[model samples]
Target chain A: MSPQHRALATREAILRAAAEEFDRLGYDAAPLSAILERSGVTKGAFYFHFPSKEALASAIVQVQDDTWPRLTGQWRDRGLDPLRTLIGLFEEAVSLLSRDVVLRAGVRLAADRDVGYPGLSSAHLRWEKVLGDLLLAARDAGQLRPGVDPEAAARTLTSAALGARLISSATCRCADFPERMREVWRLVLPGLATDEWCPPALEVLAAPQEP
Target chain B: MSPQHRALATREAILRAAAEEFDRLGYDAAPLSAILERSGVTKGAFYFHFPSKEALASAIVQVQDDTWPRLTGQWRDRGLDPLRTLIGLFEEAVSLLSRDVVLRAGVRLAADRDVGYPGLSSAHLRWEKVLGDLLLAARDAGQLRPGVDPEAAARTLTSAALGARLISSATCRCADFPERMREVWRLVLPGLATDEWCPPALEVLAAPQEP
Candidate 1:
């Protein structure tokens, strides 16, 4: 491998190992030695790539951005029906909750006081705007209720998705998580649509997919 | 003073002192010696009232329950108007958030992983049931719209409240917290309410209360 390629691989390995450790033990309890051992990288290589544990944590926060877009970015702007796009996003997230232990642990770890992860806050700002823009488009298309507040709906919907994820982690079971989330969307979407429209296959929306 | 009267006063003082210390420095960081000094009670007196720091922390948690009841516990059985009750509860919580520093800090401490505070799980359980019961009552009363799942809504609402509180603490300027929370309520309530019911005063419900 080229020197640059080898360096990139080492960096990725370090972040992957750090993500798991931080998730399992939180930022405060995670030891640098353990991360080093897990990644099979020297202290020199680790410091060459990242200066401190907090820096590694900051990288994990960035990794989530890449992860989601990789998994579901294609759904966005794919010219699919907007409702379908939204349902697809929820399905993908629920799938990750059940299938991706690292991602799941990363999320719960973000809630810890010490981590101070800004990953979700950044995601919230961008996603809320995207959702708001979509809802506004649907409103102009005469597909949504006249009085629906797109920004507010977007905010609530985002919180609902997150709320489901939180519960899924706490219960250690996603058996009820997807269905419960769909129920929230079912209630929300009808109230949002102009003619009290209900999505035909709410069950499909609740179907779990492999991450 | 009677022996019983003296013991009660001393216990209350220790709880107050410990809460202040815990609120300031967090559960793990706050020292028992500091609490004793602040309360001006002997170490023997403190031990007599509470067996361990965990016991003292539990007392602090009890103090939290004692404070919020008049402000929040009133949401139960205030008639069948879910939208109104929902609005009322959010408004009350917001009002409390603005005024209650110790309660706010204590909750943040409870959520902290580094503290390992044991009272948080129990407090969350109590909160979940209370909120769930209220939502269930609303659904039964037909105030909530058809297909609106009470359990999901309750969980979502609780998460939203938690996220909002955490955000407010991090941002340190809650001037808009209540308004934002009201927007959450506004977005969800119409979906949850029956057709016959239009929310009584959405603007009023969203507005901050008079001092």
Candidate 2:
């Protein structure tokens, strides 16, 4: 590997180990010594990548934030309609949350009141905005129910998705995330989408997709 | 005041102040000294009531658990049907969560990955059970739509309600709880309830209550 590539690899190692520590313990309890030990990286290398535990936390959240837009952009490029894009976006999130430790840790840290990283809650607001914009497009495209409030629907769906993560992880360690999200969209789409769009949206959510 | 009354008051004071500190600073950051200063109780008196900070955390969660049953029983005694009963319960919870610091602290602690207290997650499981049983009763009473999964619906609603709390507090410190919950039920009930009951449940959720 090139010098820069090796450096990137070391940083990834530290981040993976740190995310595991944070995911297993929380921000308050996850110590730097353990992260370094688990990563098998020297103290100098660890400090070179992350100055503090909070910095590691910010890195994990940054990874998740970057993942969201990229995934959404990919789905958007598929030419799916707005309502379908929302469904596709949620499906991708549920799948990623189940497998990605860094993503799960980012989510856990965001909800955790202990983590003081300033950038944490912004992810949630960004997500709500993303959902809102999609719902607005869905409405304008004649896909949403006539009385559905886009802003309220956006926040409600965002909250539900967030809650789905919390309950799923707290209980089954996120093994049930996809099923939980499927149930959320099953109920929500029926009320939020127009008659024509609701059934098809439900069908898409009910149908399984390749990860 | 009588000696017994004085002791009770002191304990209540410690609990209130501790809950305030926990609510503001989270579990790890909330110091007993700040709680003591805020409660205006001596260290000796504080120890007399709560053996440790974990005990204080337990007391807050206990208060919330006790309130759930009492509030639910009161609503049940009003002879509400199963579906309406669920609506009434969630509405009360939303209102209570907005103003009750102890209750909010319990919720915060329950979701906090840092808190090691064993009792925190039982509240969530208990809540899921309560919602499940109610949905089951509603199904048995022919109040549900065809093809609705009661267990999934139960878990879905619990997750959504839990999510509403997290988002509300994260953004607006829970002033938006009522509005958040209203949007939740508005989106959830239409898909979960039968044609006859869905509209009325939405009405109850939408109409302002006496609280």
Candidate 3:
């Protein structure tokens, strides 16, 4: 491999190590030495790629942020209904969070107080906007019930999803996240969707495959 | 004051200071020196009362736990409907969390990653049981719908409340916690309660006074 290709590979290895460290031990408790050991990279290579722990954490957040558009774009390309598309996005997240150390670490780092990252709230705001826009679109398409405020629904749903994820992580190591989210939708959709949309929404939630 | 009374006061003061420190700086970053400075107590006196920061955090959790029974007892004594009483209990918590630094501090400490206090999960378990019992009563009293499972509802509501409180604290310093909770109940109640209970439940939520 070219020297540049090797450099990129080393950078990716360092980030993966940092993400796992943050996910397992949290930001404050996770040490740079452990990350270096986990990555099997010397301190020189590590610092050459990422200067500080904060920089490594920020890169994780950035990488996590980059995934959102790609995930959502895939659903949008499928031409599914807006609400189904939203559920699809979250389902994708749940799957990623369950298996992907980098994404899980990104979430942990975002919420870690000692890390001092503001990305968590911004991420919430972005998701709220995305969900709100989708709900509005569903309403426009006569999918949502009349008089249901899309913004309020979006805010509540976002909060509920976040709460569910946290509780799942704490109580069950997120083993039941997809199931918990299904319960959230079961309770929330009735108030948001018209009768005609309920069946398909449930179908989307129940189906194992991506839309 | 008697010497015993003075000691008790000193202990209380130290706990308060520790709680505030943990709440503001989080567990990993909060220093014992800052706690001592905040309490205006000597290091010796602080150590005399609480052996360590972990002990101080445990004491704060204990104090927060003690408040729950007293608050719930007050609602139970009023002979209010079960659903209303449940709402009252949470309403009381919101009020305390708003004005009481110690309670807010306890919550922040419980959620803090570096703290690692199992008391937090136990507290959640306790609340879930309390809520589950209340929800079962509400179901029996015909306040809740016939098919709803009280245990599941209780778990969801507990998780949702925790999530909402976290979001509120981070986003608004919990200035809007009551309003945020109101929205939670607004969305959750329709699924849990019968139609007849809706109006009264809404009224219970709207009332500023403790029921």
Write model 3 residue lDDT over B40-154, tens digit each, in one string.
9988998898899888887787777788888878888999889989998898888788667788777766555323321134566678898999999998998887667788788
Q: Positional deviation of B121 in candidate 2, in angstroms?
A: 2.6
- In angstroms, the error of model 1 at B29 is 8.1
Ordering by TM-score: 2, 3, 1
DockQ of candidate 1 is: 0.27
**DockQ (0 to 1) for model 3:** 0.33
Order of models, best lDDT first = 2, 3, 1
Point out the higher-scoring one by lDDT: 1 or 3. Answer: 3
For candidate 3 chain A, the 10 contiguous residues with the lowest summed lDDT are A113-122
Ranking by DockQ: 2, 3, 1
- Compute DockQ for each candidate against the true complex: 0.27, 0.45, 0.33
Model 2 lDDT at residue A153: 91
Spell out the clash pairs found in candidate 1: B145-B192
At residue A203, candidate 1 shows an lDDT of 51
Find the candidate with the highest TM-score and give its number. 2
The lowest-lDDT stretch of 10 consecutive residues in candidate 2 chain B is: B111-120
TM-score to true structure, per model? 0.71, 0.88, 0.81
